[model samples]
Target: MNKILIVSQQGLARSTLKTALYGEHIVIEAGSAAEAMARAQEYRPHLIVLDMDMGGENSAEICMTFKEHDATSYIPLILLSEQGQKDDIINGLHAGADDYITKPIDPIELLARIDTHLRTKEYFADLEKSDLLMLFELIDIISVTRNPKKILDIIVEKVSCYTEVSRCSIINIDIDGNLAVVASNDLKKNQKITLDLKNYPEIENALITKRPVVLEDLGSNPLMAAVKDKIKHIVNESIVVVPIIKKQNVIGTFFLRTVSTLKGDRAERMNKLCQIVANISGNALENAVLFETLQSNKNMLENLAIRDSLTGLYNHQYFYARFEEEFSRAERYASPLSCMFIDIDDFKKVNDTYGHIAGDLAIRKISLMLNQLLRKSDIAARYGGDEFVLILPSVDQAQARSLAERVMTMVREVSVPQLYGQRITVSIGLATYVNKNYTSYEELLHYADAAMYRAKSAGKDSIFVTG
Candidate 1:
């Protein structure tokens, strides 16, 4: 039940108000300003009715006191004055009276005014509840995704939907004062655009103050004077920028623009919501940045473990591991698998004539050529210095020989500019597993290596195949 406090020195006036409000509300009466303040603080009434006649107790000052006190500030205050006391009525309202009733008070008008203020209070209460619920929902939704881009996108999308703004965006400002629109309601996810900080004076002010900046009228706001001409064509009439702060520093802002002019209670509510969201965004962005950094470090460590630092190909240990698995699969399924061993001819001569650096360059060039010629399923790795190995799945002897010929032709065509335009060649040996009774994949690799030595014996830059 709502509590109403009626302050009047006259017994007749207090009785009249109580009689009218008795059944609908619980009425508390105070005969003086001091007693009225005591009752107001004790009961914490939903509304206050103060008679301006106060027996010369400065009724307007009493009203101002109630409006200023934290406990009674939000309680609705109505002033009762004589019918023609225009100055008293004006003074009461100016002193923060929410409403007023005349000395010859009409019971119906009194009831109606009281009900209006009570309904407005209920509405503001509901709005506060709804805002809190929306904030919780937003936090829940953004917390489930680990992608930094998606998290920012969700924030702007939710804010835009709730605020119904012309534009809602999360902009990140770096230490260099560069602004980047990390996410926007109108843009695709992961799409970012750079913006000049000077163009957005409201955002710049918010960042400087580390507080929310609101401009209800862009045309009239002094902060927007510099950009007034540039934004003259824009239909938006209001803008709000709430800084997202982290560790006492302003990292970014929740930028919003709307066509409607937000003022009074509506503007205050919007500012409160955006400030709460900015606090939440700061924590969310921090977690996302940390997650991305950890994920990047993890991937870097994994790559270093399995990748050749020089050629960027799979290292020898990783190649052997994969070879074991592929050979087992091929044997189990009775599928054809080919292996090739390539040895660069006179690789030591290049190292001796030029340097080991040129030798490394030549090896890198051949590695690149192999990578370009091979299919996705083919695996190539540097088995050792100047010696490379390949494993081709689902390839027969004819296919393996064809691939070896191509590798020789490409390698012959490659000239090392560091070797003073000298061309180099490779001896390649191809071995295919069809019906061969190879005990293990190692046996197949041995056959290919033996054939490569035979190619070196016969002539350089030749391919030899072992049955």
Candidate 2:
């Protein structure tokens, strides 16, 4: 049912394969590598059995040429070499041989290898159809979510479920060009999981090739010699690294590590699924990143509207807006509401004598002291130039007057070192809402303003109270 190409320079080895494969397959024999390539181009055999020792180009070189050819790469090639040519066998495998058979090859063993490759091809064909359906499901999942953490979790979960790897991790390349584990499943405890592209040449190769890098066994790789002990201590067996590509750049990596060797069909399946997840996740991640940046910018713009530029206190407009809400709450609860109108004593003289910068420094210091002194529920705001307002929700006339005296003492002690140790003082006017007289916010504001004028007339640094 399948076409098999036998490539051997020796007539004896070629006849041996043809006799063994006779009626089972349509056996096509070639006596040399050149004839094998020409017949392979014409016949397009399902599999190739090449003799390693008796070849024009060595079996490994021929294997590499076959793998590099676009048309012949998919056709599985098994190398037949001498009994003790272990090095040549390894070289052949590295050159991309699907399987290897040794000379004095048993007829049953060689046929079994052929059957394995054929079955694997059939299994992969089925997996392709199923993988296509899975890809659509992944695309649908990406469409509904904008949260980056949520999306990454879904990716890790899906990859783990679809491909039964011992452990899986999605390593993100951050803005700083460092790799961090965004999501992982079944990661080893106490394992120092660190992967940098610079440190791992195999991983770097995967990124550059934009393809999967499969290391069937870490023990056999010379390139992994530097990190062999470290890898053996951690993963030790096999790892499949696939690059998550976006716009010709590797944004991240999908790593699957296992104790079992990943080879042939299993490796191909994992690589295919990795590419699917990488393609779908790249755009979803980008969208989530953009959304986070936009949200941060939006919050900053909203803060700019209500926050004072210099003192970092609430501005006059926002103070009025908050006052209305606090006033309504106090009225509904029948709570005592008090407001203090504070004016800096001789503020105009300070600005003229010390300069505007020193005046700003004084304002900032006062604001910082207010923030430290005020209760969480109390509101403090810069009403306008050289004046501030405080709203206390549950304070009566007696309490307001006591608080005002303490504030007067504190303001007098508030000296600005930047202004040559200039001491600042303030005149306070307090207004308490009486049960029926101060029914409206406007009435309370007017009473506080009147009290402030009275305090100014009586003395520059004093407190005046009105109900």
Best by TM-score: 1
Candidate 2 collision pairs? none
Worst 10 residues of 2 by lDDT: 248-257
Clash count for candidate 2 is 0
- Per-residue lDDT for 1-467 in model 1, tens only? 78999999999999889887978899999999889989998999999999887887998899999989998999999998885576888988999998887655556457756865776533445256667777888899877666767777777777777774667778876433467888888888778899987788877666544456777767777888898898786524666677665532212334433333566677667766776687687777767765775687877657656866557677778888888888898898999899999999998788767654356668877888889999999999888768999999999999999899989999998765557778899999888887756767898899999999999998878989988
- Top-lDDT structure, candidate number: 1
* Cα displacement (Å) at residue 189, model 1: 28
Instruction: Give the alpha-carbon lDDT of every model.
Output: 0.78, 0.73
Please identify model 2 stretches exceeding 4 Å from their true place: 1-298
Task: Please identify model 1 stretches exceeding 4 Å from their true place.
Answer: 1-298
Per-residue lDDT for 52-102 in model 2, tens only? 976446778888989999889999999988855779999999999988876
Give me the overall lDDT of model 1.
0.78
